[model samples]
Target: MSKGLKTLLAGAALLLVWGALAAYTAQMSLPSLGGGIAYDPLFVPQLLIGAGIVLAIILMVQGIRPLLAGIRIADEEPQKTGRILFVIVAVGLYFAAMPVLGFPLSSAVFLLVFAFALGYRKPVGLVATAILGPLVIWYVFTAGLEAPLPAWPSF
Candidate 1:
């Protein structure tokens, strides 16, 4: 089998697993609150999973098209292992810092650092995205969804 085929198959297998997990999440029992405050805890998870599945399917189709046309996919440049590791470690630290630094602060810091790590320059855009993105999400969750996130640190 070609490397592309193998990769595609592996991705399909992962998508299958993700779909199963999403199915389980969809079946989760929602909490019943008085005054018809029906809250589906799995909404965000299911929505994200659905989006991932759709994107994966689109990518799979793109991969399969060239293969079906008998065109060899060009080998791309190898990714830097150090950069990948940095991102992994940074994400771990971001999660760990959330409770202590609060979601807004930690998210801003993480977004800034993560974008920088990915080689995004342009200070104004980076700073705006880093600051405003989390704030918008915070508002949506806290105000729109009625789900309160950790806005400020306890300490």
Candidate 2:
């Protein structure tokens, strides 16, 4: 099968899955106290799923032209699957360590290791990013959004 045909089929499948999930989310019960309010627990999920379904449909429509013309899209260079797997494992470990080490510490450590693994060799840059990035993110989530984040370890 042509690449366009494959793309169209994949997009259609994704659209179907997203639509079903969105429908299911829409059926979930809202909080009783918030009956007259605009807020609903499933609102965000439904919105995101709706967006995904729209995007997938667009992709499928775009693919149809090339598919009908019997044109095959050129494949891109293969990715480094091993590096991808390593990053996934590293992220998993970071999340696993978060409860014990706390978000700031674990995130900093993860950033340092991840940067090094991705070929960033500058110690100053690595150290700065490791320290500042998590702090900024924590501040934004906690202060700006009024969301609570895991605190630093007391010890």
Best of the candidates, TM-score: 1
Worst 10 residues of 2 by lDDT: 32-41
Error of 1 at 146 (Å): 0.9
Q: On residues 1-155, what C-alpha lDDT tens digit does candidate 2 reach at each position?
A: 56677788989999999988977776777674576434666766767897998899998988798978867876566568899999899989998888778779999999999999999999999999999999999999989999887877645
Could you give me the TM-score of model 1 versus the true structure? 0.51
Structural similarity to truth (TM-score) of each candidate: 0.51, 0.49
Q: Which stretches of candidate 2 lie over 4 Å from their true place?
A: 1-75, 153-155
Shift in Å, residue 63, candidate 1 = 25
lDDT, candidate 2, equals 0.85
Q: After superposition, how far is residue 55 of candidate 1 from its true place, in Å?
A: 30
lDDT of 1 by residue, 1-155 (tens): 55566557766876897789888886788774545433556667778898878877876776687678787755566567899899889999998999888889999999998998799998999999999999999999999999988889879
Shift in Å, residue 44, candidate 1: 32
